[model samples]
Target: MKRTTGQLAVVIAALVAGSATAQDMSKIVNTPHNMANLDVWGVVIPENQVCLPCHTPHNARAVEDGASQILWNHALTEQTFEMYTTAAGHQGGQPEGTSKLCLSCHDGATAIDDFGGNEDTFDNVMIPADRLSNMGTDLRDDHPIGIEYPPPDLTGYNDKSTFTGVKVVTINGVDRVECASCHTAHDNSYGKFLRQTMEGSALCVECHDK
Candidate 1:
């Protein structure tokens, strides 16, 4: 029987929790069941790798600017991006939430094998550097980040009718709803840790309509 996404998340989380050491993470990746699932996200991480990619064994760094979540070895990507929206909701900057972690590899600027706090120059890494011209510094073509979900002006909006609740996440004393709020880094019931699955235009409408 095919396991539900929730079930799979539970299993993956349990595996990570049980193994506290980085070297032991290989067991979770090598598990026959999870190997297939990891492929779904296009995660090409190899077995026998350290757990720091997603989890940490000791003194894991913070994920956000001020928050204290267990961050792995990879230096978070610091690129600004443009989000999709017809309204002028996002005004300040790009979203950094979990996307920072995603971009550490997907941005095509950093090496996949690069890790630890050595801060060595890119020339030293064995993995070849990515040379994709399309992966430019300007992220207008990519998804946007660092935007507020609910604007201050919701006079015409009905929260109840929209099937939504107010989320109070404050970063640097400023109220904002970022990509990480709706996503998870460890394990999630939905693909890519999205709060909900986006089918057709439904996903876009969930946050855009309001």
Candidate 2:
């Protein structure tokens, strides 16, 4: 019997839960070897409500561009970035997924003090203009996103078909790359939510035309 991806997720979650408790300050104040751990712009978020900088349990709300199923407690920034693509071979399109989440703080466009619970309006919130440093809106030199990985013919990849986990994601009749497709939200041996181990260009070739 073949186990589905959903089944695998359940198993991974169960394993993670058994070893860890609710995300607390002590867990986040330290290093970020795991997802439950927190690292704000490479700096450890201090204990207190600061941990609420991103994750929250009660009133978490999703951002405008992300999946509505998940709750987001942070106020997402509006800045854009250069994404990765094959045209430049090094550039990318619009930033998405965890990268977007990372930029919410790293971009410096939004105030760190402004959280989901804050009553301060967007304009009222003051983020330092000089401190703000971002990749910017043109994503040609970053990494490519929002592209479908599946081919019209699946058999061409031969035995590598199982590894080709790409799926179609259509938004308003247009398609975009979803974070979950390449990055497993649950337990993974690889860093940065990657779906598989990284040895040379293994992860990139998994979906690209190469």
**lDDT, candidates in the order shown:** 0.50, 0.51
Q: What is candidate 1's lDDT per residue for 1-210, written digit by digit as tens?
A: 999999999999988877645434224443322323444434344454536455557766667665335556666655554455535554546545445565665565555445554355332222223444224445656455555445666544324235332232456665555545455443433444455556564445555553
Off by over 4 Å in 1: 1-50, 62-64, 78-90, 94-97, 117-136, 154-169
| Residue 106 miss distance in model 1 (angstroms) | 2.9
lDDT of 2 by residue, 1-210 (tens): 899999999999998886555434133333242322423333323354535656677778666555333566666668766555553242324555554665565465655545655535423333345542343455454345555444333323222345554343444454455555555444344655466656776776666546
What TM-score number comes out for model 2?
0.50
Would you estimate the TM-scores of all the predictions?
0.53, 0.50
Question: Residue 86 of model 1: what lDDT?
Answer: 31
Sliding window of 10 residues with minimal summed lDDT for model 2: 30-39
In model 1, the worst 10-residue window by lDDT is 121-130
Off by over 4 Å in 2: 1-51, 82-99, 106-108, 111-113, 118-138, 151-161, 164-175, 178-181, 184-188
